[model samples]
Target: MSDTVEGPFFHGTKADLQVGDLLTAGFRSNYRPEIVMNHVYFTALRDGAGLAAELAPGDAAPRVYVVEPTGAFEDDPNVTDRKFPGNPTRSYRSREPLRVVGEVLDWTRLTPEALQGWRDRLAALRAEDRDEIIN
Candidate 1:
């Protein structure tokens, strides 16, 4: 991974948060609720966060918030070099808290069909027992 990454970073979630709220680690994993996450994840890409928001489990609407890291962060090892060749995802995680700065209202939303496709893919991964998260 690179030594550092620059960002006007973003985090996606179903949780309603106000500006200045601190997003910290130790929350349950969105992908696997059984595990408590050791790091808080975010992305430099706006739509990437949007996708995460869409996939987040809950009836509430997805939200993408502009954020600032309060401490050092690094590339998300789960996808950085393992899934993609490099950090094409611009994804990162931090053990420290990320402060919400603002929200993105104009982000692209997935179509119903596209959203179903992702759900189907996730189900398939679960069936194959391949939904392993590095954290």
Candidate 2:
């Protein structure tokens, strides 16, 4: 049987972020939290023709998009405008799921405390599963 493999986790909170959180020089990639941010957004410079096909030909709001918190964002000051340089994906809206934002830490470089926290959650889930089986 295959062993149940847990995973590396993230360590951060809203307190860890700010409205204009800028990435430091040390932050090199979107794969690491210290490298970039967990939350950010980007918009398409031009309306995608694919999305426009669905609508009747007329003047209306363009279907611009923003990337969801797919993973930690890459810090790129060059991507000016509404887009946050931290994430490769663009976010169209302001709100996003916390789970998606948690990918700030690199899987290859997880923090000790973050791993512990993940273990705790996994243990709880396992316990819950056991309780369901016996009851």
Candidate 3:
């Protein structure tokens, strides 16, 4: 993406994710966000719904924050807050430790149709798995 720090993450609203979804969050820094990738589906934990995403590689696990309809919105840790009714603006906070990854190819600029395709692809991956959580 034009503005980003990490990779392999998806960006969207709660409607974009399902229960038992799990995937790495592509971030910018150890402090705030750079770019968000919400096109892919995940094996969601009982973790989040309003823009659900997991921390990157090194942070601890089980850290999540809920961004609801009335929640406050602010600049991403690295950028400014964006207000768009078409876009969800719920704040997500996690306390886990994870390692940040490089951003994907223009993750923030994908068209809705492209995102939908990625969503479908991710869903297909999950469907093929059947056994999601670690055994």
Candidate 4:
């Protein structure tokens, strides 16, 4: 993978955040709460972040925020070459904090049916023990 990526990065979550909030690593994995995350994840694709937001576990509404990495980041190892070749998802992670620069209000939201479909897929993966999260 390349050594650098440019952004206009974004993070998706259900956490309520403000303009100056700093997102950091060492949080629990959204996909697997038993495992703590080592990196703060973000993406260059708005829709990708939106998908993460939708899947994020919470009763609070999903939100996507514009972010700036405070330190070096790299292609997410979980999906970079394992799932698709060469970071087509534009996904990344950082050990350092990511500053919330702004919020993205106009990102596409998934339809209820679409959301259910994704949930079903996740459930199936879990049932089959195929939902391995590399955290």
- Each candidate: what lDDT? 0.90, 0.32, 0.31, 0.90
Off by over 4 Å in 2: 1-108
lDDT of 4 by residue, 48-72 (tens): 9999999999999999999998888
Measured on C-alpha atoms, candidate 4 has an lDDT of 0.90
* Candidate 4, position 72, lDDT: 85
TM-score for each model: 0.90, 0.22, 0.23, 0.90
List, residue by residue over 51-127, the lDDT tens digit for candidate 1. 99999999999999999999888889888778876789999999989999999999999999999999888778666
Q: Which ten residues in a row have the lowest lDDT in candidate 1?
A: 126-135
Tally clashes: model 4.
0
Residues 1-135, candidate 3: write the lDDT tens digits: 113222222233322333334334353432124336432222112222211333222334323322121122222331124433322332233322222222222222345576467557656755665556443
* Reference-based TM-score, model 4: 0.90
> What's the residue-level lDDT of 1 in candidate 2?
6
The alpha-carbon RMSD values of the candidates against the true structure, listed in the order shown, are 3.2, 20.1, 16.3, 3.2
- List runs of model 3 lying over 4 Å from the truth: 1-107, 131-135
